[model samples]
Target: MANAIWHQWVGCEYRVLKTAKENIVSQRSASPVLSSYARLQRFILTALLCWTVFTPGAVQASEELHYALTVNVNFGQDLGQPLGSLFEVRDSQGEVVLGAGFASVYNTMLQGNRHELQLYLHGDRDEALEISSLPRPSPAMGTFITAYNGELLANAMNYGSPMVWDSASTTWREDTTAPRYYQTPVASGNLVFRPSQVEYQGRTIFASERTTALFFYGAGNLFAWEEGESDLSKAKVHAVPWTPDRDRADMDHAATLELATSSAFPYCYGVLDNEVLMVSNLGWLYGFDGEQWRLIQDNSGNVFQMYTMLNVYDRLLLGNFPTGGIYAWDGNTLEFVSAPLDYAHSGMFEAQTFALYGGDLYVGMWPWGELWRYSVLDNEWNLAARLFSHPERDSDLLTPYRSLLRTEFPSREYSSHSLGQRVYSLLPLSGSLYASTSARSGRDGRDIFHFLSQQELDQYGAVHRITAPTEASAQIRWTGEPTTFVLEVHSDSLRILQDGVE
Candidate 1:
């Protein structure tokens, strides 16, 4: 590994200006980190940020243009998904120059969500702001949630193993021993293992698979709790995943009292009124107070199933799947924040993901891949854009997609693996918001769905960078003196961050 200020990379030298604040690249301490020779491939690379000055026609194959930085980063052997253009570079008009990112084409279920954080690397050492690559998982898959809490942990989804960067060993290792991977459900095979659900509560990050939740604290501590108490039978389980139930039928509902202490699929670790409150997919509300479990509510039988949750201006907003709304838990019942985000579509209209761009809330829905923006100035929820426009999906008809309500409701049918769509992730980067979509389950980066045309199939697992329309004035909202935006996905949203908020 070659020397670097923030991260160790081979074949290239990286240096950063510490004045970049939140986006700054620097080591934790003043001591120099050791480096070693790595087995990384070499490539002749140059970042031509001065493209604005160049002519329109192409030059000779061997021709070299005037460039800013010659950088090549494939930190964990991520060669195919190479670092695309320089980020945060502006033209004379202060517009974002480069527009490229590593996007998955087929299997969004596992490979759909890769975030483009910072791609800045000037030629000068002191004035340069380098963008380093995150290490891939050992048995590599895709980049989903890359969290930094003094240490870097990049998580691949269900099928792929999670990889943590070992600063001690100076290598990426499969997260097998530190705390074991969450086990598959009882009597269930690997198919029941959904994608890992990652949520944050206070200074803790909770990443779950099946019944177990792995907690990573900001102070560099990690623990996995697969056990819980039962609300139905009042049974106790010490090292438990007593909430037993597959996605298809009621496996947990038919269990006896003695073995009912197990848990089901957990969604988010919600903190309300200073207590750790968490809800299961089977409508089980549990509270853990650093000691034992307490059942808060049991709204079982498909009552209130939520996939994602967010904290919107002090309100804990939970994304309800069955009800098709944005709700908040009030210690007793779920109240509506935004009702039925996408009623225009059939199938489960779930508010699956969310993001905060320009201090306004933007929510992404499922099945139809609808993205909505909450207009605080207008006090209404507006349709931002439909991220997916597959020709097969009609606004009036919804089926052909896998849903959780398939078994319960006879009319709700499960389709093939390529039919489902989830607006899986919403990321705000480079002053623009990007939404990602995923299938129910997909192959290892292969788009075997011959049914979809290339134009229609492109929507799945694609990150649509929100750009602007022609009429910029209608998109702007004047807040007395300063100007806010009604449509968050405007051309101005593509500008580089001035205040450092992605």
Candidate 2:
């Protein structure tokens, strides 16, 4: 009876006895033939349904994710006002972020030498993340010096003590014993230390106070202390005294050069092409072959103090202090290209500074607190922006006359402040501008500011929040009947079925 019922269901319009015999034969050939066939059909149907519902587009919508970040600059020192702010991000979004409020951590009127502040970024629903802190130093410690090595930012307190801030970790650690510190003193008393010249031949050669002899520090060598002193000394001066390969010995012999003066007191030295150029405070230019330092010129004759010098475009560019002017030195002569507005000297007062950005030179006259941009190509000058301004009158009383601007030519249009209350450095990071300012007195008064790009700032209705995706219901699914029946029925049969008269 069961076999008859199965045959009737399988072969509804065909020969029932023939179908029953075929089914019995298939059952004998394979175990549970009917049940397995039904199961496979159901699986295929379910798979088809799943494929239709979860297409590539649907899968992408579910897996998307976003990470948010907010950067804060706290002034650890004594600054009159907040310098600026910037938003930095490390995520898949690949865009610069911005903060919502201007959080003030110090009151300048109180005149407190020590102040501490924290920069906070509000995430979704006012959830705050403290990005960094600014700590005020003791009065005796003086100002701090910071250095940026592409990925890591390092600062030295009181000249030799080093501290490193990791952008990835958003934390600060003391690096007082960093390996880069050689016996070379970068600063002394009131004088700032500048590298007059640097020579690299598998080692670094720099001129410092201690030795008239050329000092060589090997590549990848850490800072080591001398036998009995609290300070370190030069590791190696002459070429590798001994080498296993005779070829390397010959190469070193050919590569070595002798300096003209046993005393390395020259204020400026740099390499150009295969030749090296050195400039002295008394206005002399010296060139060095692989053999000796030959005198190039007795005097530069330009009426400016050489504060910074660079070899650019096969020409030697010199930055002058007191009179903020730029001079170009060809192999034979020095010519003045342009000067800052009012011929303002960087040494005139505190807070006066300048930097090179995008092949143009920028000068900041402090107390006046105005920014001037010099176009090297056009040989013209324009006011880029006003950082701080005092009324034309009474500028003397309020101006510090000792502002500092330390940066290489900036490729991007953003800026940042250092430890001083003024903008210490202005540069771009990840499509946004960061400004860092320092206070004169405390560990907690340093402030870092961020400015976002125009496109990102425009996206927000009020420039405080970001747009996020909302969840929604699943899309509808469709099922279809077999196509064999459609082919069997004609247009008239289909119309009859539609009319409900089948």
Candidate 2: tens digits of C-alpha lDDT, residues 239-269: 2221211112222332332332333234443
CA error at residue 250 for candidate 1, angstroms: 34
CA lDDT for candidate 2: 0.27
lDDT of 1 at 364: 73
What is the per-residue lDDT of model 1 for residues 362-422, given as tens digits with 9 covering 90 to 100?
6777666677766443456677676556545555545344342344345544343345566
Candidate 2's clash total is 61
Which numbered prediction scores highest in lDDT against the true structure? 1
lDDT of candidates 1 onward, in order:
0.36, 0.27
Candidate 2, poorest ten consecutive residues by summed lDDT: 1-10
Query: Which regions of candidate 2 deviate over 4 angstroms?
Result: 1-149, 157-160, 168-171, 176-264, 297-304, 345-359, 363-371, 375-379, 383-502
Best by TM-score, which number?
1
